[model samples]
Target: MSDLITVEIPLGERSYNVVIGPEALMTVSPLVAEMMQRGRAIIVTDEIVAQHHLAGVKTLLTAQGLTVETITMPPGETSKSFAGLEGVVSRLLDLNVDRNETIIALGGGVIGDLAGFAAAVTKRGVNFIQIPTTLLSQVDSSVGGKTGINTGHGKNFVGAFHQPRMVVADLGLLTTLPDRELLSGYAEIVKAALIDDARLFDSLEKIGVQVFDSRALSQAIAAAVAFKARIVAEDEQERGRRALLNLGHTFGHAFEAEAPKDVIRHGEAVAAGMALAFEYSVQLGVCPAEDAARVIAHLDDIGLPSEAGKLAHTQWDARRLVARMRDDKKNQDGRITLILARGIGNAYIETNVDEEDLVAFLETKLK
Candidate 1:
C-alpha cells in the first residue's frame, strides 16, 4: 500500500525513531506524543515553512490536546549562527519553558540545527523533537544528533550532541522544496551512497534528477538513515566509523567557511566538495577517470554546482581553511584526518593525509 519505510536510531538511553513517507507531517503529533512525557511542546519553524505547513503542524498538535507554542524564525542558514540561537533561547525563556518541555524543530536544517542547540543549552538540557521539513534536514541533519551554530570561525564550529526525542521526516513537505534545495539535499544522499552502497550510486546514475519526488525520496532518506544509524550505533561520538559520513565534508567545510557564507548554502558547498573529492580519488589512482566523471555528471544532472568562483581552483587559502580544519572534532593527535573514496561505495578513512598534500590536491585537482 504505502511506499514508505521507517528506520529506528538505536542509542540505548538516547534512542529515537525516524518516520518517513508522504503521510509523515500529519502523523507527527501522534508519533511525538508517544515519545514525549506529557510535557509542553514548542514548535519552532522558519517563516517560509510557516507559510506552507505550520498551520497543519499546529492543528495536529492541538488536536492531540497538547499545549503548543509556535516560534517562527527568519529564513536561511544564518539562522544557524550564534545570534539566532540566542534569540530562540530568549524566546524559550520568555515562554518559561520547564526542563521537561519539548522543542519541536519544524523546518529545514537551519531550524533543526539551531533549535536543537537551544534545547541542548537551555537550563542545561531539555527534550526536543525534529520535524525536518526540507530534503536536506530530513535525510541528513535531522537524523544526526549533532546540533550547533556556525561561528565567524567556521561552519558548525560551536555545537553539541543533543539528540532529538524523535524525528518525523515527511516526504510530503519536500514537495514544496525549491529545486536548488532539493539538489542540495541530494548531495548528502550521494555522499552516503558513495561511502556505503554502490547500488545506491547506480540508482542515482539511472535517475539523473534535478528535483525530487516522494517515491524516490522515501528510498533515499531511508538508505541514508540506515547507514548513519549504523555508524552512530557503533560510534556515537564520531570517534571512528562515523567519520565516513564526512567523506566530502572536510573539503566542503573549508569551502563553506572560506567563501561568503551568505551566498553559498551549506549543501551547495558540499556538492562542490564531493566533486573535489571525486577528483582527488582519481589522482590517488584509487578511482578510474570515468568514475570521477560520473560523480560530476550526477551532481550537474541534479542541478548542483560542481565548481565555485572564489573557492574553486587556486590554493583554497590553505592557511585559512586548514586553520578551521584543525578545529574539527575529528582531528586526532593534532592531525586532521578525512574520509576519501577509492570509487563509488569504496570510501576509507586516511589518517595520514599530509596538509601540504591535501592543499596541493585541492589546488590542482579541485582547480
Candidate 2:
C-alpha cells in the first residue's frame, strides 16, 4: 500500500477520519476494528459493485477475525428510496445485526446513502463506515454525515444526519470507473474548490480531467475532504456554515427532478446547476459575468453538462423546473435559498429569491 492521506473530521464524540490514498481498501479492516471492539460487520453494496469489490471486502474483514454478512441491492439513484431503505433495514434485522456491529457501506453514493440511513434508523442507530467506490462518493458524499433517501417530491427529502465511523476512499478503485462517473465526481471536487479554495480551482482548471492522475487525484481528494470536514465540524446539521456546500445543489436538484432521468446524473446536473448559479448571480448583479464564464468554460471543457440548452437527449421545460425548486428543502417560508457566487471562490446564501425572476432566468437558459 502507498502512503495514505488521512483527513480527520472533528466532531467531538461524532468525529471520524477520512482515509484517502491508492489501495486504501486494504486498510478498512484494521481501521474499523480499531474503532469498534467486538461485533460482526454487515457489508451493504450494490449488485454491480458486488461483482467487483464485495469479495475483497469480505476477505479483508474475515481475515481480521470479524464475522461478515453481505447485502446486495440494485445500483442507481432509485435505490435511495424509502423501499430500498426499508429493505436494507429489514435485511439487517433478519441477520440479527446487533447494535454494536457496524454496517459497512461499500459502494457509491446510492449504497452509502441507503445503508447509512438504514444504520441511522436501525436499533435507533448503529455503527457505520463508508467505503465509497466512485469519485463522487469518495470526495463528498462519504465524508459528510448527511444520509437520506430521495422522495417523489424531491432529492434527499427524507434523511438523517448520521455520521460514519470512518470513510475509506481508495483512489486506485477509480481506475475502473467509467469516464462519465469519473466526471460526475469531478463536478463535486470542483464544487469544493469553488466554495472556498481559489488556489485549488486554479489547479483543477490547469490540470483539466487529468486531475484523475494518481498524484492529482490524491491531492484533490484530500483537499475536498479537508474542506468538507471543516464545514461539517462547524455545522454538522447544516444550520449555518455547512449550507455553503450546497452551492449548486438547489438548481442542480431542480435539473435532476425535471430533466430526463437518463439524460443527467447528479454530478452532471450539478455541473449545469453550478453554471446556472453563476449565470443567475451575474443576472442578479452580484457575480461578474467573466467569472461565471470561466467556471462554465472549465466545466464544458471536461465534457460535463454545463449548459441547459446543450443537455442532450432531454426536453427542457423551465416552468416545471421552477416548480421543482419550490419543493426543494432549501426553501423557507415560501421563499427559496440559493448559494450564489460573488465571484470565483466566493459563494453566499441568497434567500427569498423571487420565483418569477427564477422562471425568467430558466426561460433564458432553455432558450
Candidate 3:
C-alpha cells in the first residue's frame, strides 16, 4: 500500500479527515468502530458497486465485530431522486436504525448523494461516512458534505448541507472504473485547478490524462481534496468564497438538466460547463481568449466534451439551457450567479450577468 494522504476538514465538532490512497478501505472499519461503539452499520450502495467491493467491505467490517446491513439501489443519476431517498430511508426505518448507527455510502456520486441525504433526514440526521469508488466522487462529492438528489428544475436543487463523519477515498477502487468514468472524474480535478490552484492546472497540463494511470493520481486527488477542504471549512454553507468550487457547475448543471437520462455523465457535463464558463468569461471580456483556448485545448486533448454541441446524442438549445440556469440553486433575486474566471485559477462569483448576453453567447456556441 502507498502512503496515505489525510486531508483534514476543520469544521470544529463536525470535522472529519479524508484519507486518500490505495487500499484506504482498511481505514473504514476502525473509523466506524470508533464512531459507534455499539450500533451496527448500514451500507448504502448501488447494484454496480455491490458487485465490486461490497462483499469485501462487509466482511471486513463484520470481522471487526460490527454488525452490518446493506441497501443496494439501481445505478445512475435516476437513483438520486425523491423516490430513491424514500426507498433508502424506508429501509433504514424498517431496520430500526438508531441515531447512533452510521450510514456508509459505498459507491460513486449517486450513492454518496443518496446515502448522505438519507443520513441527513433519517432520525433527524444520523452520522454517515463516504467511501466513494469513482474518481469523480473521490476528488469532488466525497469530500464536501453537500448531499442531495436532482429535481426536474435542475440538478442538486433539492439537497442538504449535511457533512459526513468521514470520507475514505480508496484509489484502488478506481482501477475498476471504465475509462470514460475516470475521464468524467478528471473534469472535477481540472475544475479545482481552474478555481484556485493554477499550479495544479499546470501540472495537469504537463501530465495530461496520464495522471489517471500514474503516481501523480494520488497527488492530484490530494490537491483537489485539500483545496475543497479549505473552501468548505471557510464556508460550509457556501455563503461566500466557497462558491468558487462551483466554477463550472452552474453551466454543467444546466446541461445535465436538459440532457436525456444516461445521455451524459455529471463529469462530462461539468467539462462542457467549464469550457462554456471560460468561453463565456472571454465573451464578457473578463477572461483572456488565450486562457479560454488553453482550457478548451486541455479538455479536448482529454476527450471530454468542451461544448454542448460537442456532446453526443443531444441537440442543445440556448434558450432552454438558459432557462435551466435560471433555476440554479446559486441564483439570488432572479439574477444568475456564475463563477467566471479572469484566467486560470482566478475564478470569482459574478451575479450581475445579463441573461440576454448569456443567451446570445450560448447561441453562438450551439451554432
TM-score of each: 0.91, 0.96, 0.96
Q: Which ranges of candidate 2 are over 4 A from the true structure? A: 35-39
Model 3, 1-367: lDDT tens digits are: 3477888999999899898887787755676667754557789999999999898888878877788889999998889999999999999999888887778999999999999999999999888999999999999998879999987765677889899988988888888888999999999999999999999999999998688864689889999999999999889998899989888888888887787777888899989999999999998889999999999999999889888878764688899888888887788899999999999999999999899999999899888
**lDDT digits (tens) for residues 193-264 of candidate 1:** 888899988987897762266677788789888988998999887777888888778877777766664656
Stretch of 10 with least lDDT, candidate 3: 30-39
TM-score of 2: 0.96
The deviation in Å at residue 325 for candidate 3 is 0.7
Where does model 3 exceed 4 Å of error?
none
Please, what is the whole-model Cα lDDT of each candidate in the order they appear? Answer: 0.80, 0.86, 0.88
Clashing pairs in 3: none
Residues 294-318, candidate 2: write the lDDT tens digits.
9999998888988876565357788
| lDDT, model 3 | 0.88
Largest lDDT belongs to which candidate? 3
| TM-score of candidate 3 versus the correct structure, residues matched by position | 0.96
